[model samples]
Target: MLVLNSGSSSVKYQLLDMADGRRLAGGLAERIGESGGGGRIVHTSGDGGRRERTLPFPDHAAALGAVGEELRADGLGLDSPGLAAVGHRVVHGGTRFTEPTLVTDEVLEEVRALTPLAPLHNPANVTGIETARALRPDLPQVAVFDTAFHATLPEAAARYAVDRAVADRFSVRRYGFHGTSHQYVSRAAAGLLGREPSEVNVIVLHLGNGASASAVAGGVCVETSMGMTPLEGLVMGTRSGDLDPAVVFHLSRVGGLTMDEVDDLLNRRSGLVGLCGDNDMREIVRRREEGDREAAVAFDVYVHRLRKYIGAYTAVLGRVDALVFTAGVGENSAPVRAAATAGLEGLGITVDPELNAGRGGGARLVSPPGARVPVAVVPTDEEFEIARQAFALVGRSPR
Candidate 1:
């Protein structure tokens, strides 16, 4: 399976053998159509060999052409008979798509129609879908939506408290993002506990630059932190999450800022960077160690919000068997993990200081022995999840 995550100016591609879930090859193409054309790509083969090159790719088609060439060099081109389908990461599925869908013309059009809900993402997704379909017309193209896993959100959790008529007219509601990561992490956590997913309850904290938390009950997502957009939940590197809606009105009416300005401020100018002029957690930790007050305050605010959600999700989930963390900061950044779970012993949550200080790549528990609620760091595999779903949908002995 070939999984493609298309952004406006870049494309991240991976070729995986879903039979054994081995990544045969992967690469990224970026700076597409930039003036003077210095598009760059770094491809990695199954043997862990890496190569980097620069080209003058004019558009997505050209960029993908280079990717195909790279794959062909590794003896795994797009036309390989073993390849079953291409899975696309479409950001906003709205309430329409609840599962991975085969990409038909009607499905493409519906995804295009969802642009208003995800103005920044769906268009790029549509372009990637069209480009891949055009490149391989005979192969199946599947869309694995980021919101599909959270489709189980009950009405009370999904709906906003605004006027029902107005909210419905504009399709305004909580449609959480990073669902693929949350779903992957939840099941992984269940596995680590030596239980079936249906027999376990867990809270997943995906704390990358873009962060979110989810309460997974019996393999279903009953509640999550991100809502309506990726910007509604955790305090991320750039996004200002969980701000009062009236803040926008205040900025617009009194501060004389336009809606676009307010949007830029919250999504681009806020969060950790907004707080301390740095977004990377490692840098923040270093500065705080050096007695930097600004970094200290930013780190505290970040963890304070994290602890709040941890407590809130605990109440939502009557029994949380494990607390799982994933993504960039969650996987590394021992300081953040220690601080986030510090003093939560009463909830059966306490990081083993010695274990938390150590760093390893694979999944492992950081809680002390026999802790009631275990704390774990499980790396998320969204690409593998995408390929797995796509393979299940259209992967019958590839033609």
Candidate 2:
């Protein structure tokens, strides 16, 4: 199965051998719509063979065509009978799509209709789906939504405190993003604990450029940080996660800023970038070490918000068997792990400095021996999860 995660100007793809769940090959095509400079695609095979090309890719169709050529070089072309299906990472599914579905014209339209909910993402997903469909019309295409796993959220948790009639008319409710990563990491955490998913409760914190926290009770999402969109979660690289909604009014009426300007401020110019001048954690940490007060405060705010979610979700889950961290910052930033879990001993969460600082590649516990609740760093595999869900939906087995 081929899992495609398409963005506004990039396409990330992986060909997986579903029988054993091994990635056969993968590649990325970036800067697709740029004008002067040519785009780049880098393909790598399981055996470590690599091929890179720099060429003009004016659109997704052109980029995907180049991707197909590279795959053919690896004897894993989309037309190959061994290729089962194409699984797409759709950002929003609204309140309708709750699971991976075989893509159809209606499905595409529905995805397009949901664009207003995911203005920056769903359109790119639709483009990838369309391009893949045109490339191999005979192949089955599947959509594994980032919001699907959070569909299990109950009414009390999903509904906003706005007017019921108005919210319903506008579909204003919590539809958490990063469901794929949360689902994968939660299950993986359960496995690390030597327990069945149904027997464990997990708090998964996916801290990437965009971040979100989820409370999973017995494999089902009970509450998540992101609501209705990806911008409502923890402090992110550029996005201001949780803010006073009236700030919009204040900015427009008092600050003399337009809605679009406010939107751009919150979505593009806030969070770590807003707090400190830098958004990258590594750079922020380096600056903090060099006595940059702004970076220190930014890191504090980031971890402060993170710790708040941890406490809130711990209360939501009652007994969190595993506090799992995943994604770029979650998996790699030792300072974040230590800081987020610091002083939470009463809540059965404590990180061992030695273990937390260790550079183990795979999922493993960072908590001290026999800690009340194990703190784990589980690497998220959304592509593999997408491929697994896609192949399962089509009832196709790998060769």
Question: What are the lDDT figures for the candidates, one per model?
Answer: 0.93, 0.94
- What global local distance difference test value does model 2 have? 0.94
RMSD over all Cα atoms, model 1: 1.6
Show the colliding residue pairs in model 2.
175-228
What candidate 2 gets wrong by more than 4 Å, as runs, is 397-399
Listed in order, each prediction's TM-score against the native is: 0.98, 0.98
Q: Model 1: which residue pairs collide?
A: 175-228
Per-residue CA lDDT of model 2 for 243-271, tens digit only, reads 99999999999999988999899999999
TM for candidate 1 is: 0.98
